[model samples]
Target: MEKKRYYNDNIGPIKENEVLALKKALELCNEIGDITQITLLIHTKGNTGYLERIFETRNLKDFFRGVKIDQNYPPLKIETVRTFNDDWQGKKIVVAFGLRSNELHKYDDYENVAGIIAHQWSEDSVKDWAQSWGAIDLKTETEIEKTALPDKVVQQAFIDLTNSINMTTGITHPMDEEQCKTYIRALKKYDYELNSKEIFSFLTTELNWESDNANDVIKLIDKVNSGGYFKGGAKTGLQHHIKRWKSK
Candidate 1:
C-alpha cells in the first residue's frame, strides 16, 4: 500500500481495459479466499448495461452495486483510486476503485475510496445465510472512526487478528494519555479525524484499526499479553480493555 495507486473504470462507454481491471481484482479476491459477495457500482446508466457482461467474465457475478457516485457528489470520484489496501473479512482485497480516465482528478494520485466503500459494505447474520461484503478495501483509521461496523469489521478484525498470532511486540506511536483518550473517543464521533492531530495520530499509529496486517496485529496482541503497559498481570488486559471503554 506504500506505493502510489490508481484506478479507472469505464462507467459509460465501457472500456475493455477497465472491465479487465475490475475482473482481475475480483479474481484475485476469490483466489485468496471465498468471495461471499461483491458490490458493483457503475458511474453511469450506460455502464449498468455492462454490469452483467462484466460479471459474466468471472464468478464475481453477484458483488455488483452500480451507482453514479460522480454524478451527484464529485468528491466521491476521488475515491475511485483509493483501493490499494481495502480490508474485508480481515483479508486485504486486490482491487482498485475508480471511475473513467475522463473523470477529473481531485488529488494528485486520485485514490480515495477508503471511507465510501466502508459506508456501502454490510453484513447480515440471518442463520447460516449470514454474509459480509467489501473485503477488498482498506478502511483508514479516520474512516474507521466514521463507520458503525456491522460486526463485519469487528468479526473481520477478530479473524484477521486470529490468523496473525505470532505474538510480537507492538509499539504504539507516542501519544499523550489525553491524545490516546481523544483518539478512542473519536470512535463515537463521526468525522473525528477532521482534527489535524488525528491525521498525525493515524500516520504515527499505522492506519488505526490497530494494524490489520496479520503479523502486525498478532505481534500487537502478543506485546499486550507480555505486559507492554498494563497495570496488573495478564488479567490486566481484560481490565485495560474495560477501563479503556468504560473510561470513555
Candidate 2:
C-alpha cells in the first residue's frame, strides 16, 4: 500500500490582512483533492492566543486537516517540522510559504518528505529549495491582494513580534535591552504609537508573569532606558542570532 503524503505550509502567525493568503492555501489544498492531507504550520515562540482568536473570527478551524504550532518557548527546542514529522503517519510534501533562507534546510533531513510546493510569498532561497527537488512553484498560481493592516492590528502585531523575540531569546528578567530596542525600531514600521508603559502592560499580560516579576521587569526597563540603551540607531542583530539558532 502506498503511504499517504501530507502537504505542509509555514503560515506563521496569521494576521488580519493575511486571511487571503490562508484562503488561497486552503483552496490549493482542496484542488489537490485531499484536504485531509493538508497541514498548516505556524512557527512562534509565543503563545497562540492571537492565532486562536483569528481562527475563531474567520471560522478557519474546520478548513484544514491539521494545525501545528511550536509548543516550547525560548531557545526553540522542538520545531513544528520535527514535531509534525514525529506525529506523521506517512510521507509529507512540504508546501513552503514565505520561508526564510535559514528555514529552507529543515525538511532535508526528514525521510518521509520528498517534495515541496513553493507557494506565493516564498523567498528566493525557498524557491531554490523547491527547484532542487523538482517541485512545483505556486508563485503565480495565487493572487493575494495587498491590504494594509488596521492601526489596532498593527499595534498588536508589534506586541506579538516583541513577545516572540523575547521568548525565543530567553529574556526572562527584563526582556533584554537589545530586544526592547528592536521592538522600538519595529514601531517605526507602524503608525500606531505605543508608550513604554503600554508596552510593559501588554508584555506582562501576555507573559502572565507574577506581580513581583512584572514589577522587576518594569524596573529593569526603566534602568535600561536610563542607561540610554533604548535610543537605538539600528535594529539589533537579534534577528541574525535567531536565524542562526533556528537553523540548528
Candidate 3:
C-alpha cells in the first residue's frame, strides 16, 4: 500500500498523522516558551525530504499559522539578514531567519523570498514590524547630528525617556502621564505581573482609550514592563503621581 500524503501551501507533502503530532508539539512548545524557534521537516515523493525554519522572533505568532512541513527530513536552515535603522537612535538590529535546504540559490529573488518567509519582506513592513516590536524609531546619530531636532530640551527628553525604559521590557516608546497612571492602577487592581499576557488582555478589555487596537494594548504592556514612568516604583516618584490620578 502507498504511504498516505498530506498537503500544505508552503511545505508541500506531509503525512497526515505527522501533521497532527507536529501541531500538538508546537502547542506545547509555545506554552512553555520553547517556541523561540521552530523547525519543520517536509517529505515529498521523488524528492528528498526538506527541512526549514521560517519564522523569526515576534514573527512566530504573526506569521506562523501551523507547522505544515513533513517530519521525515531533518531540519535544514538558510540565513536571512535584516538590517534596519532604529526609530530614534538609528541603531540597527540584525535579525536572521532561516530558509530550507538548498533553497537559497534556487531563485534569483533570494532577498524577497527571505523577507516573505520572515513575514517582513517589504521595507515599509519591516519598519512597521520593528517599531511594533519596540525598536526605537529615531533618526540615526548622523542624521541627528546634521538635522537635530531644533528643540534641544525636547530631544533630551526623548533620549532620557527612551533610555529610562529597559530594552528587555520590549518597549520602544514611553507612555504619557495619564496613560501611565491608568496602567499602574490596573496592575495593582488585577495583581497581574507586569507585562504579562494577562495584563495585555485586561488593558484590551478595560481601557476605553482612543487607540483600541489589540496590538496597542500589548505595546503599552511592554512599556509598563520596561519600567516606563513607574520605573523604580515609589522611589521614582511616579507612584505618587499615579496615586493622585487614581484618587481623581
Model 2 residue pairs with clashes: none
Q: What are the lDDT figures for the candidates, one per model? A: 0.29, 0.40, 0.29
TM-scores of all candidate predictions against the true structure: 0.26, 0.31, 0.21
TM-score for candidate 3: 0.21
Error of 1 at 62 (Å): 8.7
Ranking by lDDT: 2, 3, 1
Residue-level lDDT tens digits of model 2 in 106-166: 4443445434343334224443333322333233443222122224543454445455654
What is candidate 1's lDDT per residue for 116-234, written digit by digit as tens? 12111112111111111112222221211222232222233233323333323222322222223332233223221122222222322333332222223234334443545422223
Give all candidate RMSDs, comma-separated: 16.6, 16.8, 18.8
Give the runs in model 3 whose Cα sits over 4 Å from its true position: 1-181, 185-192, 202-212, 230-248
Instruction: Kindly indicate the candidate among 2 and 3 with the higher lDDT.
Output: 2
lDDT of 2: 0.40
Enumerate clash totals for all models, in the order shown: 24, 0, 7
